[model samples]
Every structure is written in C-alpha cells, then in structure tokens.
Target: MMRWLITGGCGFMGSNFIRYWLKNHTEDYILNLDKLTYAGNPDNLKMIENHPHYRFVLGDITDPQAIESLVPEFDGIINFAAETHVDRSIAQPRDFILTDMVGTYNLLEAARFHQKKLIQISTDEVYGNCPSGQNTEQAPLLPGNPYSASKGGADLLCLAYHQTYKVDVMITRSCNCYGPYQYPEKLIPLFITNLLEGKKLPLYGDGSCIREWIYIQDYCSALDIVIQKGKTGEIYNISTGEGIPNLEVTRLILQEMGMSEDLIEMVDDRQGHDRRYSLDASQIRQLGWNPEYLFSMGLKETLQWYRHNENWWRKIKSGEYQQYYRQQYAQRHKKSTLER
Candidate 1:
C-alpha cells in the first residue's frame, strides 16, 4: 500500500481527488492535510473520514515544520494546496504569493530532503490566455495576473529543484475543472446556486473568454496516471480537447437549469481577464490517460449535485465565506464583490 500525504484535501478538486483515489486505489493510505480555511469544509470528506486507509490532519503548507514532519513519513506527496481563486487572488495578491508560491517552495524543499515522489497539481492559467490554438507542454509561461503568476512561480521552483537537485517531482497542469464539492463561488456552481436563489448569473465582461473545461473526476484520473507512470521532472496537460466560451457555458448551464438567458447579470470584466485558453492534452493520452465525461453529461451531473447538496454550499455561502471575504477584501476593494 502506498502512503500518501495530500495537501488541500478539503478544497474542491482536492476533495474529489481524495474520494476518487480512495475508491480506486483501495490499497493506498492517504493523509489529508488541510488548513480548514474558509473555502475548505471537512464535510466534503465526511463519507471517507473513517475509511481505514484515510487520515486527516489540520495544517497549512506554509508551516515548514508541519510539512517537514509529514514529508518523511509518506512514500508520496500530492500537493493540492493553494489559494485557487483568481478573483480572490486579484483581491488579495499577497496571500496568493505567500500560499501559492512560498507554500509550494516549502513543500518542494520538504519532499526533496525526504526523497519522496512529489506531485504538483497545477492549472492551465500558467499559460495565460491562448486566443488561437492549444498550448503544448512547451508553451511559454505568460501569467496575466497575480494568481497565475504565483502558480507559475511555484511550478518554476518545482522544475528548478528537479534540474538543480534532482528532486522527484511530476507536475500536471489541468484545464478549468468543474464537478461536485467545488466551492460555490466558482463559475458553474455560482451560476447554479444563483439561479436557484433567483439571483443574477454574474458573467464577467461580455463572457466571451474561452476556456477548455474538464470534469473533476477526469482531471483526477489524469493525476492518477501521473502518480503511477509519469516521468519525474515532466509536465502533463490535462483537458477534454474542447473549448467553450464563458458566455456559452453559462448559457448552456442556465438552459439546463430552466433559466432564461436574460437572467444573466453582465458585470465589468475582471482586471487582466484572460481572453481564451486551451490545452493540448496529447501527452497525457500518450501516457494512457483520457477524459471520460462529456461537457453535457458533466454539466447535467454537476447541476444535479448542487440541487441535491444545498446545505453544503449554503453553509459556505453564509458562514465562512462571508466572514473570510469581508475579512480579506471587504474594505480593500470597492467593486461590490459577489464572491466570484
């Protein structure tokens, strides 16, 4: 059985990954480390907390001692920890730099010293907005804002460790992920929840920005391939080989929700908003990995999830989310934030 330590296990993608991994790899042991931040809710993993192979530890990645002690104890390290929201990153850039960049540095150093296989879960945002064709693994890094820049910076440190110190690290940059257990503030869930509440479906700018989307389960499957067979010091791009504009995606989700297109609330575009992004996921397919769910099926499933799990996001939309947003960016910005 593999002993694995996973950071950010309480977040959206992290939570889904943990659930998927446990069910698939029954022989593995996972120590889930999360800070239980405003976005993190342990209820996401309540179903598996008592699983014999699963363990939960409340902590932050920036805490060097906390990460160091655990690094030596696990056979592999999968880092899902980060300040993930781009809008929130724009609102609080310093936290992004600290958690996304510095936190990664801390984990890398710990893993390097322990000689553990480290898996860095990343996003396609590192390549910025690719308006035309898809971005291959060699695509130049051009982060358009603090959030992407921070993530790119962390990836650099991972590569540098591999080059300079021969650290065992495999990085996977996946396209925009959507599925169950995601924080309610994200694009799909936000629109879903807003529609249910009869609120405006906030669409940034003209909602024309294009993005390659992948179901969360498929994204996790790619990571599973990386952890099992991918080469160290290499990057894998995970996507569904389909690009959809934010406006069209919103329309599709709203249409499924039985909501009118006029319910969309057009808002000013985000600062440094990406125009489009697409990933060439050929490499992961070469490694015997592929996306399973189509966008239509995934969207329908996600909508049903939110509809069934109102209490989960409702608690977040009310308690921790309100306090965290206010405390982090209340008086700082004056754009009337809506928890994007």
Candidate 2:
C-alpha cells in the first residue's frame, strides 16, 4: 500500500482531502500533519481519527526537525499548510511569508533529501486579477495581496526545486473552495453563519469582485487525479469555470436562507483586492478530471450543511471567533477606512 503524508490535514480543504482519500483509495494510507492553527480544527477529521490507515501528527512544516523525521517514512507529501486568509495576511504578512515560503522550503528540502515526491497545493490568486480570459498554467504570476504573494513565492520555490535539484514535484493551483468544515472566516461560511446568528452580512465595497468557485469535493477529486496521474515538474490548474460576483453569492445565500438583502452591511473594501480570478484548468481536464457539482447544487448543499450543523459553527463563532471577527471587520465597518 502506498503511504502519503498530508500536511495541514486539519484545515478545510485538507480535511476534505483526507476523507476523500480514505473513502476512495482503500489501498493507500495517510499520515496527517497539522500545526492546528486558528483555522485548523482537528474536530473536522474526528471521524477518521481511529481508522487503521490514518494517523495524525501535530507538527509544523517550518520545523525542519519535524519534517526530516517524517520524510523518510512516506512515499509522497502533499503540502496544504499555508496562511490563507487575505485579511489575516494583511494584518500579519510575516506569518504568511514565514509559513507559505519558509515552511514550503523546509518541506522541499526534506523531500529532496529523501527523494520523495511532493505536491504543492496552491491557489488561483497567484495569477492575480484575470479581468479578461481564463489563466492557463503558463500565465504570469502577479499576486496582489500578501497571502497570494506568499503562495506565489511557495509555488516558485517548488518549481525551482524541480529544476535545480531534480526533486520530484508537482503543483496544482485551484480556485476558491467552499463546503462543510470550512472556517467561518472565509466568505461562504462567514455569510452563512452570520445570517444564522442573526448578524448582518459584511459585504465588502460594492461587492463586485468576482471569483471562480469549486466545490470542496470536486477540488479533492482534482487533487487526487493530479497526485495519481500528473507528471512531475509540471503545474496544473483546477477550476469549475464558474465565475460569480461576491454580491451575487451573498444574494444567493440570503435568498436561500429566507433572509433579506437589507441584512448585507456594506463595508470598506480590502486592500489590493483583485477584481477577478479565473483558471483554464484544461491541463487537469486532460488528465480525466472534471467538477461534479454545479454552482447551484454546491450552493444548496453548502447552505444545508450550515443549517443542520448549527452546533459545530456555534462553537467556532464563540470566544476566539468573536475576537477575530471584531478585529478583522471593526475598522472596515467605518466608511472612511478602505485599506484592508
């Protein structure tokens, strides 16, 4: 059986990937390593905590000693560890730089020394705003925010390792992913949980910024395909080709929840916010991978998940979440402050 190490497995997409792997790839085993940051919730993977083929390692990727000890025991490493929120990155760019770049470098070093295959999970933000056509794998990197810049730096590091050291590496850049177990700090879950809690949805600027949406499950499937069939030293884009405006997404959520648009509180726009993001994803499609859920269906399922799992989100929205939410949006609540 093939053995794999999945870093950041306690986070949203990572947890979904772990569950997807356990369910579909019975012959493979997974060792999950997560630093359990604010966004990393171990409860997300509680279902698989006791599985025979599953293991959890509480560690940080930036810790060379930690990665060095584990690299020799795995066949491949899929790195999902990153500081992902744009607001968080703006407030603390150093964290993003350290985690996304330095941490990735450590992983690359360990993987290179052990001659282990490595997969770098990245985001479409690295391509910056795609105001016109969809971006292919060869598109130029023009990251706008600290978070994207850090991710872009990590992507470059992975490519550099492949070219300079001949380390087995592959990269997959995906669009915005939404579904169950996502931290409420993100857009979709934030809006859903806000409405559920009787709070006004914080709508940024005019809410015209657009993003390509991909369901978490579909994203996991695409990652699996890349890991199994993708060629080393190559980059793949994974997208559903569904571009929707932030305003429209908020309206849909409000409509689905039987709430009103009046609850949307217009807030100051984020700093260096990209106007749009799109990915061609043709390369991954050539590898026999396609998104299964349409935007409408995915929205419905996501809303239903939040509706039924009130307790799960309630616990998250309490205590630390309240402090974070206030810190993130309190200044934006004013009309004069527009930066970040």
Candidate 3:
C-alpha cells in the first residue's frame, strides 16, 4: 500500500481528486496538506473526512520546515497548491509568485533530497493566446498575466530540477476543468451560482474568448494514469478538445437554468485576457487514456450539483469572497454598445 501526499487538498480540484483517489484506490493512503485558503473549503471533502485511508494536515507548502518534515513520509507528492484566480493574481501578484513559484521550489527541494516522485499540476493558461491550431506539449510558453506567469515559472523550475538535480518530476498542463465542489470564484461556478441566486451573469469582453473544458472526473482519471505510468521529466497536456466561446457557454448556462438572456451583463474584459487556449492531448491518449464525458453531460451534472448544494457555496460567497468580488467585478462598468 503506497502512501502519497497531496498538497492543496482542501481546494476544489484537489478535494475532488482526494475523493476520487480514495474511492478507486482502496489500498492506498493519502495525507492531505492544505493552508485552508479562501478557495480551500473543508466542506468539499466533508463526506470522506473519516475515511480510514485518508488524513488531513493543516499546513502551508511555503514553509520549508513543514514540507521537509512531510515529504519523507510519502512515497511521492502531487502538488495542487497555488494562487489560482486571475483577478486575485492581478491585484496581488506577489502572493502568486510566493506560492506558485517559491512554494513549488520548497516541494522540489524536499522531493529531491528524499528521492521521491513529484507530480506538478499545471494549466493551459501558460501558453497564453492560441489563435490558431492546437499546441502540443512542446509549444512555447507565452504567459500573459501574473497568474499564468507564476505558473509558467513553476513549470520551468520543475523542469530545471529534473534536469540539473535528476529529480523524478513530471508535469501535467490541463485545460479548464468544471464540476461539483468548485468555488464560485471561477467562471462556470460563478455563473452557475449566480443564476441559482437570481443574480446577473457577468460576461467579460463580449464573452468571445474561447477555452477548452474538461470534466473533473475525466481529469482525475487522467491524472491517476499519469501518476502510475507517466515518464519522469516529461510533460503532458490533459484536455477534452471541446473548445467554446465564453458567450456561448454563458448562453448555454442560462438556457439550462431557464433564465433569460437579459441576465448577462457585458462587463469590461480582463486586462491581457487570452483570446483562446487549446491543447493536443495526443501524448496522454497514447498512454491508453481518453475522456468520457461530453460538455453536455458534464454541464448537466455540474448544474445539478450547485442546485442542491446551496448552503456550501452560499457560505463561501457570503464571506471574504464578497469583498474580493466587489473589488474585482463590481467596479467593472458595462461596455458601451458602440464598442460592441
């Protein structure tokens, strides 16, 4: 029975992964380390808190002492810790650098010294705007904003460690993921929760920017395979290749919720927002993996999740997120019709 450490385990994707891992790998044990940041809600994994094979530790990856003490216990590490939100990153770039870059450095050092495998979770935003064909794993990183820049910096550090120190590390860069237990700060969850509460949906920059989406389960399954079979010092991209414009997704969400189009508020676009992002998942597919859920099936499941879990998201949106929301989107004025 292998024991693993999953950092940032209380956040949306990380929490979902813990549930997925423990359910499928009954013999394996997971120790979850989280700082309990704003997006890291303990409620996400409330059902599995008492699982015999799972344990939670309240800690930060930024602290070298904490990571050094823990890395030796686990056979390997899967790092999900980061300052993820783009809006928040724009307002506080230093935090993103500190966690996404420096925190990753600490984990790398610990893993290097302990001779353990490290799986770094990354994102497609590192490629910035992809106005044309799909980008392969070898595509150059041209991160536009502070959030993507920080992530890109971490990815580079992982590669450097693998090359210079012979650290057993692999990186996975995934497209946008949507599913249950996602904090409302993200696009899909924010729109879903807002529609549920009869609030206006903020559509940025006429909502034309395109992005690929993948179900959380599909990503978890892909990651599981990566952990078991991925090559050391290699990078993989996980995606559904299902690209759609933000406006279309907003309209689809409105249609699914039986809400009027009037609920869409055309707000000013984010600074340096990429026009599109798409990845060719040929490498992962060659590893005998493929996505199961289409956007329609995933969207239905996601909507149902938020529909029933009102109390979970309501508590988050009503707390510190409210103040940040006001600072981020509340100040954005509706774009003039002439600009459209």
Q: RMSD to the native, candidate 2? A: 8.1
Model 1 TM-score, 2 decimals: 0.93
lDDT per model vs. reference: 0.87, 0.90, 0.90
lDDT of 2 at 74: 88
Model 3 residue runs over 4 Å out of place are 320-340
Worst 10 residues of 1 by lDDT: 331-340
What does candidate 2's lDDT look like per residue over 154-270, in tens digits?
999999999999999999999999999999999999999998888999988999999999999999999989988999999999999999999999999998888989999999999
Residue 305 lDDT in model 2?
A: 95
Model 1, C-alpha of 258: deviation from truth (Å): 1.3
lDDT of each residue in 1-340, candidate 1, tens digit only = 8888899988899999999999999988888887767777777888986787887777789899988877887898888999989999889899889888999999999988888888999889999989888899999999999999999999999999999989999899999999999888899999898888888988999998998889998898888888888998999999998799899999998889887899988999999899998999899999999788999999999999999999878877768555654344323322321110
- Which digits, one per residue and each the tens of the lDDT, describe model 3 over residues 171-233? 999999999999898999999999888899998998999999999999999999998889999
Per-model TM against the reference = 0.93, 0.93, 0.94
Residue pairs whose backbone atoms clash in candidate 2: none
- Alpha-carbon deviation at 103 in model 3, angstroms: 0.3
Evaluation by lDDT, superior candidate among 1 and 2: 2
